[model samples]
Target: MGVHGHAVGVDFGTSTSLVAARAGRLPVEVVPLGRTTRSFPSIAGFRGEQLLVGEDTDDLSGDAVIRSAKRAITQNLETLSVAGRRIPADEVITALLAEIGRRAEAVDQPLSMARDLRLGCPAMWDGAQRQRLLGLAEKAGFPIDETTLVDEPIAAGIAWVMNRSLFYGERLEGRLLVFDMGGGTLDIAVLDVLSDGPGTEPEISVLSALGAELAGDKLDQAIAGDLTSDLAAQGHSSSSARRPELFTALVLRAARDAKIALSQRAEHRIMLPSRQLGQLPMLTYTREKLEEAFRPQMDIAEALVWAALRASRLTVRDNRSAADLRVLTPEALRGDVDYVLLAGGMSRIPYVERRLGALFPGAQVFDNAGVQPDEAIVAGLADTISYRRLNLHRPGFDFIIEWEEGGQLRQEILYPAHTPFYSPQQVLSGQSDLGFARHDRDFPGPRSGSGRLRVRSTSGEYLGLAVDNQTMDGLVVRFGNRMDFKLYCDGRILIRDGSGRALHMRVDRWPVIRGRDSGRLQLRSAVDREPIVPTGWYMDKEYAPPIR
Candidate 1:
């Protein structure tokens, strides 16, 4: 195959995209298209009946180009218009993935035969959206079975940890926070990087994490609005413009450029045509004024960082006695944060680092050394995949138990993330309320019975959250005689309910894990079952099951 056996890491970012993997001793190179870097602008353009994707699509026409496709996932979108032509998001994604495969195959000859991939997406994607993306991947000839979906924050975290040397430290320790300001989203995560243990692989654990959809584009729009206002003051309006979309597009583009310039310079200038601004004027913007306009967006981002910290179990300190909690708890540490990491392209903003540094002066914050702040996520993706591959060859990390409290009985999750690919299937056991069944049409499904069980991963290394934190922490309840659901870090599940007590199952028997000697076991046995499943908020159950 190609270098290191063909596995690829796909960073499907909101603003830009990239694919990388371990090629050899040297780091994985970005799959380039002739002269560009590893990243491709995340955009798609439609012309007549054909679709143009990535960088070339970005150049087609601002009106035709669709940037930040990931943001559209959370919206209600059936079709997108490009030059009055309607196209589905799936079609756009299919075009992009096909282009990704084409460019990758051009560089790695082994990848020519390899259709399998490890794709990364935003953590905010829900169940339906994730399935839609998977469907798109399959329609483009890359099947879901051949791919593994990782969240962007998780992949970024992995990349950050692997490239730890770049941060200048004697192997990191204590709670570190990652303030990832990317194109379409802002994610904050808290981690505890432990010293290399005598018997374990150097471990990093997530203590807390959270994210907001607001990102660079929002700031761009904010500044663009300010710029537009200035132009309007000079008499530019949609009624007078030849093409309002074109004018708005130019203003937005200029806003993005100005934002980037402010990351380095104290002041910058923006030029506009006299015709666009009532014939008497050219427009100029200083970096200070732009930052002033964008301050609201930055405030939201800062709040999200502190909110993530408050969401952690670490925040639940023992209210009574200090001896009741672990010595390493934040309270024990006198509310001190130990480490702070910076990932994603937008993180390079000088103000971001400066503000975060002021918040936790005792903690160390990491920023990559490169001209393009945006390339770090993809580069980190490459480094993460490589390091995980290496760990697969060494002694793996230990697993911890996941326990949830119930009013009566406790529920438990026996397995956690990062369990080696070759590890045997793990098991979970818990007792549920064997209560009465009512013939109720109000049930979300046709099933007759319901039982809810809460489970959490106790794995030391999760994809998105810091090490030691469970990204897949939630409840799995089956009702109408049967209950089933698949859990994930993305917080999306495929559930099914059937006849009774246990509505539907992958296998017909208990102790259901089958060996290779048995006929192929049911894939859906783990979670997938029925359709028309209702999506809603599930309360985190924290009950401990009583010992029988």
Candidate 2:
């Protein structure tokens, strides 16, 4: 059987967002709230039951809407409960996602094909947050079975790899790092590109991902604040205290504009309408002045780059160590990092390119006027969805494991995580004596006995992770059975069943188990009930009228 139809790619950004699609035809860009493919201000406002988003939300009033909610998604350690209803991070994301969906298919055909959507998620998302994103996508009209989470940096890296032929005649060699500088976050990912032959998709291996929310928007705000303070100190004050708010907003807008202009020119002029100022003149911003004003933010950017380099499997070093050689030798790791694709609007600044060039000398940087840095994430993701629909690559493997007594793990399947959705007669190998244990609440220690197979149903119906210790003399194992047991492990995603292929896996001593802490497991009389739905504010689901 073959698959027909195109998939959609969604770039749900912090300060801006976009959606792109190519359904069995050339890709057509989709813009939100206007004809522009990329929409901004990322702020949403409410005026007596009228919901306003994007540019219109910039209008400041007491009934002004939410701003920079994406930043709060990771921080803002407070729960907002209004009228006995709780609002959560996922709920906000879902609202944004639904808005994007509405815009993408707003014109003609129903976006039913977008059931197979690819979403760009941040690299800094932890396991719990990742799951929450998955749940949110499912709730926002995207089917869980069809949606695939693509890391923003990874998608950008893939875009670079795919377009490598256009830039270079030879296949790409050496490690390439994708430094994604966006409005709200900076993500750096190290990708090891494997030669997949001519016209074949490159097999990408992500060595590491490190990111921080300190991006262009933060820098702009800092610069704006500095300018506001300096102007106020110069005896410039509004008769009304509320005028400062309007003045500050204008400063921020001018700061961002000047930041972009300074990308090509050394100086730019910022016009103050003279509404708030008592006859103060307009402000002219120079590149040198802006850079000086945002030095602290630049320092943070440098720190984030160093942190990303340190997190990689390999690092640029003068000498190689024995352990390092076993993983990725310094000799193999050392090379010129190529094509630092500027994907986000933040990278539009000239200083960013100059700083990146100074940081990694000898690497060529290219920026095209047509490649919308703000919209590249969605474009690349949309292209990736198109590639997948073409069956460009196959899914990987998964490892299904079972817990036994004595802090031991047993392989329940030959392959996992990458397994096919449903496959029958798939046999696996496991051992009973393999020490796996359910901690006893009362006794609090390892028990010396064999344990039965454990399986649990995921939020996904008809999907399960089953591990049996009682099959085929504990050697031959078969999957696709219904058995309920509590299987605990260090990582959440231990299985990826891709097709009938058995993923490579091995049972070994558990990493967290120690000799002294061995007795911490105690069997309780009552079993905990399975969660029908996720708990906490992060999983709160709410619906608001679609953005008009």
- Per-residue lDDT tens digits of candidate 2, residues 180-251? 888777877766566545444455555455667768778788778766776777766543445565555567
Best candidate per TM-score, number?
Answer: 1
- What lDDT score belongs to each candidate, Candidate 1 first? 0.52, 0.50
Off by over 4 Å in 1: 1-6, 109-116, 165-169, 195-200, 272-280, 314-336, 369-373, 383-548
> For every model shown, what is its TM-score relative to the native structure?
0.67, 0.65
Model 1: worst 10 consecutive residues (lDDT sum): 422-431
Q: What is candidate 1's lDDT per residue for 1-548, written digit by digit as tens?
A: 12344456677777777776654334546666433666777778766566777766655656667777767675647677666667777678777777776777677623335443566665545435655676776676554531255556655655655555333335645666777788887876665555452222335455444566777888888889988888789787655777777677767878888888888788767875445433535567776786687678777776555545543332232232112322234333425576666777777677777777877777766675221345555555554333332211101111122223344443333222222211101100111221112222323332433343322222222212111232332224444533343322211223444432232222211111112222221222334443333332231124532111
Instruction: State candidate 2's TM-score.
Output: 0.65
For the record, the alpha-carbon RMSD of candidate 2 to the native fold, in angstroms, is 14.3
TM-score of 1: 0.67
